[model samples]
Target chain A: MKIAVCVKQVPDTWAQKRLDPDDKTLDRESVDGVINELDEYAIEEALQLGEATSGEVVVITMGPDKASETVRKALAMGADSAIHVCDAALHGSDALATSLVLAKVIGDRGFDLAIFGSESTDARMSVIPAMVAERLGQAQLTFAGKVDVEGSTVKIRRIAEHGYDEVTASLPAVISVVEKINEPRYPSFKGIMAAKKKPVERLTLAEVGVPADQVGLAAVASAVESFESAPPRAAGTVVTDEGDGGVKIAEYLSSQKFI
Target chain B: MAEILVLADHSGGEVKKVTLELLTLARSLGEPSAVVVGAGAGSTVDALAEYGARRVYVAEDAELDRHPVAPAAEVLVQLVGPHSPAAVLIASTADGKEIAARLAVRIDSGLITDAVQVDADLTATQSIFGGSVIVKSRVTRGTPVITVRPNSTAPEAAAGPCEREDLSISLSDGASRAVITNRVEEKHDARPELAEAAVVVSGGRGVGGADGFKVIEALADALGGAVGASRAATDAGWYPHQYQVGQTGKTVSPQLYVAAGISGAIQHRAGMQTSKNIVVINKDPEAPIFEVADFGVVGDLFSVVPQLTEEVVKRK
Candidate 1:
């Protein structure tokens, strides 16, 4: 019942993120980095599942050397170990390339299940889980609000358009969870001390069998052609309610043909 | 003319507004051809034709509906090899993006999601980091697979005779990896879908509790619009999470968005900033939502919302 959870290091949501002027890609260095908010939920879910089944949870992340800080945070939260896929040539890889490397790593590691956040706050593509599942030739159950495992069968309450649906798949599958699934736990001081000694394995692209020709900015399948800053919002008209505010709103709605 | 393939989204034998919006955007890129999957393609042809679909590829395979999204991606993969369209457009719904992702992998194409705009040259304008940054991107390797955000464009009616092409697709074992055991349709409400609604009334933490949503619902009903809630309210269990409007929630670009008792956080603003017109009502005058609002009213929502609903009802 070993599980692998994918985590990403992203610019903190509170900090203002900017795009690089030359390449139109995210300027990661300009802002402070933190683990993506949603991935915390995935880490927590994996830890809980591990405790429930007496299994091991391994945290995997792909980024520069600094991304190990993110993996340490997950280990402090109770994962068994960590895997860091760090390489200079992996920069600016598209979802396809990223999923390729992840699939290869997870496939080699031999996990009973793989977990991912529904999307990354940075890219917000929400595609990697499906792509990795397709590449690994495994079942994918994404956007799960609730997950349950029983006797090699995994069941999930999938978030659908209006409501939810019950979806089921076999073991050795991939799943991505939504934020509503569970509350993430904070790392205690004892956990933080213990995490420092936990095993962290670092791997390069070549170690993972990813060809040098398939990744990086030059080999990226997608390219940013251009960018434009969003237009500044105009000053809005504010009205203090002096008992006639409702009347003012009605007039405004009518002026806009809304009512 | 180069053809752009669009995956038509339909439910209950009717085409969704997002599909029409995709068709409208597709026409600007190239000649729009719709790939209709499931049992209702025949019934949806008229609407597709009205929205400028020159050709509709129909795959009436029952396995598509029985299984999850893999079968549809397989169908699209088969079509991509033969048609070699300039680009593929899909609605950026949960299921739609999944299909697009699988199709991109199967065909080894670059994929873009949540595109707010696509230029005639096929460059996609993406609003990322909770709408804090905008990047224009394009697929450099192969035919681009793009998922357009709902309500990004207004659907325009352009009459055309839609030619139908029947597609016979065989499902692979991978397509049946995940099976849907049961489905429960959401309760039908008269209000329009939040993503497609012209007007949306949303509440936030200032609403106090679940009971406070009554005033918001009344105002929404009076306006014949959809009801939305901020993540704060939804997380507090005041409303269903599905109705949440924020970075982690649904992105809505309605014509008019009313925020009552909402002290708009950046996450919430990211979902609704593209709205054509925004109105904010809050007790706090320093609310961030007022920054992007077209009009603002500083007052308590309980008093302001009920009076606004009454005024709106009286006007009609």
Candidate 2:
């Protein structure tokens, strides 16, 4: 079985984020980049599946050449090879455009399975994998908490509002892993050295058959207007812990209608 | 006039509350059309009509059942070919958001996720940088695809003419990825999800350990509100990630949000600062939660929560 895992390099959410002075969008410059949190689960799942079936895991990501860092990290984690879809036209592409680029690459490259994190932390859209599956006409599962493989078929456990439901489908599909799926493994020193020798192929929009006219911010459908800051919170009044602490507490509760 | 497509989330053939909320927001962009993909009865369609859905798209294929996020996207894309909606609206849950992303890509359109507001002009507003900033975005390019945050809009009860149309899409091999052979959903004694709920009651570090959360839960139950926990509590492993309320957790804008024993970190406020009315109860008079509170009580939670629950129960 061959699996393709989609990953995105986003600003380490732990780091502080600032807005661009010219545009309302986030300031990506100087932000420390890291593999999206959820994508780590996707890569781990792919590696595990590859080990079980004695197959291979292929890492796919779209970004500037710097995105190779995410690919290198995936390779260090146990993927067999990588594919980087890089192009200037891909900048500012929305989820739909991103998915289109991915679908083009996946369709041309071929894969038995495609996986993605539930959503990129920065964009938090969680739509690209589903879009790829739709474009590829593959069956897809979202927010998989658990997964099991049997022969060529896969079964997934999804968490719903009221209860968990089990759904089974054939391979050559896509699944967006939820946070609860599995804990991702940190890259080992040995694995990092080995990753240097692994194969990582780079593809462009033309190479993947994606027409230049079909990609980029110009192809997007939505637009943003002016933004306003959320209203400032009102000041708060603190009740002192007087000698009768319990009584004061009770009185406060009663005043607030808690009693 | 552009048509906005909405995916109706349902259970046991009944439309979920978030579905109505999605439709309510969908109406902001253009005509609202609901797509219900699954088995079971037609009760969901009726509910969609009640929520002012002008068209109900139904696709009941056994193969489509549990196809996960991938095939679901295919179904919607197939539906979009003919209808060509200006935007597609879905709930910003784990699954809903994923499917919307895929649809946006398949159609080569723009996608805005976790949107708090959808204006008449189709601009999408999102709370970014942990709710410290509100960023308004427009897909200057394809169909504007958006996943709306739950509870962003009060579901208006306005019934519209209902027309049901069954959609058909050919599922391609390898399109269905990651199949679920089994599922085990953790049971919650509380009401609906905090993000999708109209009312929420949350606890923070002041509640102490996992056991203290019971008091918060009890108060939440009395008010039929979902339970939320601050990042401090979740980080302490006292609550599940689903219950976490902060920049890293789910974003909720409900009618009423009650904070108990919470200090209201900046990250925690980022998740729920948009609530209509906020009530904070903390033992520490200096806790930050009181800063944005509409009502505040300075007292020990251990003694305050039980009495609050009793009062709420009595009123109920």
Candidate 3:
């Protein structure tokens, strides 16, 4: 079996992400970047599937050159190789346009299965994998918490309102991994060393056969104009730890009609 | 005339509330047309009409109804090929997002998911990275495809002269990528979905144990609120992950959010900080939850929640 996992590098959520004053873009200078948390689950699921089926796991990412770091982490987690579709032109591409580039590349590779995190950490749109499947004319399963591979059939479970729902898709389909699917493994020292030598294939729009008219932000059907922060949270009405604190709290709730 | 296509999300003929919410959003852009593909769709059409659908495109077939996502996309692609909707709005559920992505690719359009607000100009506001940031974007070239986040819009029922149109679509051989080998549906009473609830009561590490959550549940019931928990509570195995409301959990934007014994980490805030009004009950005055809360009480949750529940029930 051949499995392809899509991952992306995003600013660490804990890092203070300020908007760049010049262009209103994210301020990258002070932030640390890492593979999106959800994508880690995808890589782990692919590796586990590989272990079960005696297959190879190929990690795929589309971003600027630095995105190789994200792919390297996947490589360090037992993926056999990595493919990085790197180019400056791909920058600022929305989920739709980004998936266009990804679908084109994966179509060429012809993998048995493709996986992605439910959504990217920064964008969190959760649209790319399904778009890839649509573009490639493949079956798609999203937000899967559990995926079991049996020959050419794939059975999966996804988070639902009350509980989980099971779904089955044929091979050569697209699946988006959710958090509950698996606990992602930490990169091991040996795997880290091996990742340095893992084959990292780089492709650009020209190599992927994407015409200039078919890529970039121009291909995006939407654009953001301006934004402002959500309303600042109001300061709480503090009460001192006085006598009968519980009584004081109850009285407050009553007075405010919250009770 | 350009129409805004809404993929009806329903099960057993009961339309999900978000379907109406999406219709409300679709109306903001243009004429709202519902694409109903599944069982009991005639009832769905009526429901869609009551909520405000100008047209209902019905795609009824065995292959389309039994399995929802892929065939729905196939139906939409056929709809898109002829109708050429200005935008396609789907509820940003797990299934909905997948279908939207697939359809976007089939039509070679720009796809944006988890959009909190879809504006008239086509710019969509999305709460990304667990609601830490709100970024707006639009697809520049092809038709705009988007999945609207839950609770982003209030469903407004506008009676419309809904016109029903039957759509004939042939399912692609590739449509059934994954077959449904088995399906297990969860059984629960009619309870308010967490995202759609106006009031929410959540617990965290301070709840102590599984039994300790009973008081929180009572309080939530008294307030007609949905129950939620922090990642810490979920991680500790006190509650399931679905009840968790934090960065890695579900995002909720209720009108009133009551946090009991929660420390309010940035991650937890990412899921619910957008709430209209916040109230926190914790022993520690310095708990970060207070920073974002409009109301705070420094007391033990065990004692306070019960009294609050009792009072609320009495008032009701």
Candidate 4:
């Protein structure tokens, strides 16, 4: 059971994220970066599965040079090795190009299972995992709240709008886990020290068989046209309770036609 | 006019509200074609035509959904190859995004998800950065695939020449690998669907416990709306996880959103800030939710919610 957990370095979930006005791309350098919140669940799930099956857990990431920090963090949390797909041309890439690179790397490795967080906080698109699965022509078991593995087959409880569905697929599949799947473990000091000695392979787009012509903002299918801050909400009316607060609210609702 | 494919979401032989809303949006772009992939084709025709769908295509295959999303993607891909519609419009649900994603890859098109508004020329406006920033995007390659956020548009009814076509299903072996073994749908309730509800009343940590949600439900029932909860309440088991309204939960942009005892965390605000009207009821006057509310009352939710519910019921 060789498991690959894909992690991304994103700005702190609580930070003020912004897009650069000149280029309309996410301003990654303006804020402190950390491993995407939900990816920790993917890492933890991979580590637990690896431990249970006595298999190897490898971490993978794609971004600027700073992204290796996320890979190292995943390794510190018990992943055995790491791969960082870093290239200058990878900047301003959209989900399509990102999935292509991820699929190329994962396809080359022939891992039994590839895992991802449901979505990145910044983008919040939740399309990359499915896109990667399509690019590889592999089964996508996404939004999994629970996962079970047996004899080259994987089963999961896929969360849906109404409830959940029990889904099963063959091995060498792509899986995206929701946040409720498991709690991620923090790295221990000894584990962090061991990670420093672990192997981290760095590759460029060419090495992954992704041509420069097929990536970045220029190659993107959907191009950002214009952007502005959302219009400020209207002024609000605030009042402290004076025994008739509910009546006042009812009147306000009536006036607004909400009642 | 160029043809535009609109994927209609159906359940229990009825088309979903978001699909009708998508049809309204599509009418302004080009000729609207509704594609029903599963069981609801026979039952959803009138509703689809009522919302301005000029043509309806049904791929009536039980096996399409018996497998996971891949077969649906294959179906859409087959449709796109022949018609080459101006654009593809789909709902931004979890399943819809996955199906659109696979079709985008197979057709070599640019795909945009969760768009708040799409223009006549296929440019889409998206609210991002936790709903603080608005970005407009355009597809530059292949047939554009755009997924519209639910409740982003007001569904309007318009008569159209309703024509129906049944598609031939041909799914490859690889597309049917992931099989759905069992399904457990939540029991249907009388309240309106949260995402589609025009009014939503949500409770938070200050609700105290699961028992405290009664007042919240009372207000929702009085207004003929849906019930929601902040992540704190859901995480604490005070409410069902499905009813949680936040970034990681469900994003709802109702016409009127009432937050009771919820401190406006960034996650909670991101989900419902786009709502047209917001009202907050909490004991603490300084709660952050007051900043975004159109009407804020500083009072205990237990007292405020019941009184408000009574007043609304009386007016009706």
Candidate 5:
């Protein structure tokens, strides 16, 4: 099985991330960047499946220069090789453009399975994999808590609103896994050293067949008009437990007409 | 008036609250048409009509429900071909977002998900950075595709002549590739869904272990609300991941949120800071959850939860 996993470099989850005032894009330079926490699971899943089938696990990422760090991490985690799609014209690309570029890259590679984390943290839209699948004209089995691949068939226990549905799709499908799938392994010293020697192929829009005009904010469909900090919530009454704390809460609820 | 298509999410023939909320939001933009797709699509017209659906387009087909989201996206794409609606609105569930995503790609449109509000001009206001920063955005390309969060709009009743239209669609091989093998419905007895609940009671690390969640459940049950868990508690194996409320889990905007034993991390706050009223109870007085809480109680959840449950039950 030829497995491909898409990893994204996002600002540290713990960092106070902000949008650049000039472009309304993420302020990637101000904060430390790390592999999106969930994408680690995606790479891990691909690595495990790759090892099982004696296949190659190629990590795919599309971002700025700093995003290569994320690709290196995936490589360090035992991925065979990495592809970094980087270009200045890629800035401010919405989910559509980003997926368009990713689909083009994956289309050229011709992988049997393309995997992604369920959603990116900053955007949290959780729509890229579906968009990519739609663009690729393939089946999308996304939001999977568990994924199992057979010969020419893939099955997943997709997390849903009520419970989980066991979904099956043919090969050459798009699969996005949730965090519950598996615990990602940390890179070993040997693996980290080996990752430094692994091949990193860098590509641009021209190589992917997507035009510069079709991507980035200038050609995008959606635009963020303006933004501001939400007003701070006023501090409410704080009461120490005086043996009547529960009673006091009941009184407050009653006053608020909750009970 | 231009049509505004609203995908009515349903299960077992009953329409979900978020669809009504979407209908209400779509009315602000243009004529609201509710698209119900499934074998049981006809059963939800009354409820959709009650919430101001001018027309309910029912597409009855097993293939649409058998697949994940591709079939539904195809249905919407077919509907949009002739209607050319002003915009498309869907409930921002996991599947809903994916449907909107694929639809945006097929239609060459801009997509926005999890919007808290929508203006008349098709602009959407979203709570970002864990509900701390507010951003206003709009679609600039082709047709705008947007998803609305549950409870974001107060559903108002506007009795409409709910005209029924049957849509015939032949699924392409692209939309029919994925097949659902099995479905295991969630087993929560009589408890409301966490996202749709008006009141939510959540537990955190202070709940101790899996058994400690019983107290949390009791409180939620007493108040006739849903049970939620902080990421710490869920990660610690006290609860399931689906019940986890945080940036990585389900985002809930409820009328009232009672958080017990949680130390409000930015992640947890991001999922629920938009809640109208918050009450936090913790042994630690300095837990960050108190910063945004409407009421804070400095006490152990073990004691406070039971007592609160009893008080609520007695009041009822």
Candidate 6:
């Protein structure tokens, strides 16, 4: 069995991110980039599955040249090899185009299963996994909090409104796992050194057989017409407690008609 | 006039509040036509009509309820082929987004998720990057398929006599690939839901431990509000992660929000800054939470919270 894990590099969650004033796009240059926090869990799950089945795990990502760092991180975490689809024409692609490119790559690899985080930290669209599955005409199981893979069937505990539901799908399916699935392991020094020698395959839009006109900023189906920075919060009155602060708060609530 | 299709989200014959909110928003763009799936359309028709639904499409199929998402998307795609409505609106729940994505893929339409506002011209306002940036967008391709965030708009009734249309669709073989085998409903709690509550009180790492949530719960009960927690508190095991209010957790825009002992990191603020009024209580005088607070009290939350709850109870 062969496994594919899709990963993305996003701005660090702790960094102060900004948007470009002209195009309203994210100012990626201003912040430090790291592998999306949740993708680490996906990589770990794939590595564990690979070990259990005596198979191989392949990590794939689509981004600019700097994204190689993200692929290297996954390789260091125990993936057998890596694939990076780097092309200027892929910039500003919407979820549909992105899913198409990923599905093409996964189909070419002929994997038994594909894994992804429930959503990226930056986009947070939570729709790409389903879109990719639709493009491939395969089964999609998302928001999996617990996963178990038997001979040819995969069962998952899916999180829902109130509780959870048990969902099952066959092999050659796509699934997205949530953060609660498992704890990710840190890469050892030996693994890091080994990753330096592993194969890293690079592909472009044409190399992957994706038409240039079907992707990129010009091909996007949605356009941002306008944007504005969030307004700063104004300073309000602060009351120091002198054993009567509770009474003052009660008065304020009353004045605001909250009581 | 073009009709706007709304996917009604219902459970046990009762429609969710987000569905009504979507109907209200749909009416602003075009005539609202609700598409009810599964077996509960009869029970939801009156409520859908009350919210300005001019027509209701009832698609009662047991296969839809048994399978996950794909069957429902198939129904929508079949309807879209004939109706060609101006747009489709759905609540931005996990399941709803997946359905919308599949529908968009099948129909070759543009899909937008987590929209906070929609205009008469069909432009949408989205708060991206955890509400730090606001962008106005419009679909440039086929009919727009949008999933709106809950609590973004209030529901208003516009009573009308609704027309009903029964839709019949054939389920494709691929629709049954992923099947749900079992479901477990969580134990019910008496407190109001965090997203629907008008007033919310949240605690953070400053609360210290699991037992420390007692004061926060007492305050919420006294004020008839809901209780929430920062991710830091949930990650520390002080509360359940479901109750966490942050970028990664739930986004709540209530009428009144009270923060106790939270320092208001950007991630935490993203969930609650859209609230109408904010009140903060923290021992740290220079906490970031005070900057966004309408009222601030500098003191120990352990001491301040109990007294505030007592005052609220007394007033009531």
lDDT of each: 0.89, 0.77, 0.80, 0.90, 0.90, 0.87
Judged by TM-score, which candidate is best?
5
Candidate 4: which docking quality band?
A: medium
Those runs of model 2 whose alpha carbons end farther than 4 Å from true positions after fitting are A19-25, A196-199, A228-231, A238-259, B1-5, B23-33, B54-66, B69-87, B105-108, B139-143, B159-185, B204-208, B230-237, B260-270, B280-300
Q: B1-316 in candidate 5: lDDT tens per residue?
A: 8899999998868888788889888888899999999889989999999998999999988878889898889999999888899999998888899999989998999999999999999889999988878999999888899998888988887887889999888988878888998989984958877887888999999889999999999888888889999999988888988898997888999888999999999889989999988999999999999999898899988877788888998998
For model 6, report DockQ.
Answer: 0.66
Highest-DockQ candidate: 5
True contacts kept of each: 0.69, 0.61, 0.62, 0.77, 0.78, 0.70
Looking at model 3, give its docking quality level.
medium
TM-score of chain B of 2: 0.93
lDDT of 3 by residue, A123-202 (tens): 65567877787778777777787888888888778667757667777778888887767778999999999999999999
DockQ metric, candidate 1: 0.70
Candidate 4: the clashing residue pairs are none
lDDT tens digits by residue: candidate 6, A1-259:
7999999999998887776777656767788889988899899989988999998999999998888989989999999999899999988888989998999999888988899998888888889899988888878888888888899998888887566889998988888888757889998999999999999999999999999998888888888898877676677889998887767777888899988
Residue A180 CA displacement from its true place in model 1, Å? 1.7
- Candidate 3: where is the Cα deviation over 4 Å? A19-30, A240-259, B119-123, B127-136
Full candidate order by lDDT, most accurate first = 5, 4, 1, 6, 3, 2
lDDT of 4 at B288: 88
Better of 2 and 4 by TM-score: 4
Task: Write the residue-wise lDDT of candidate 6 on B157-227 in tens digits.
Answer: 99998998888778786777888999887723667667667789999989999999999999999898889
Worst 10 residues of 4 chain B by lDDT: B187-196
Which candidate would rank higher by TM-score, 1 or 5? 5
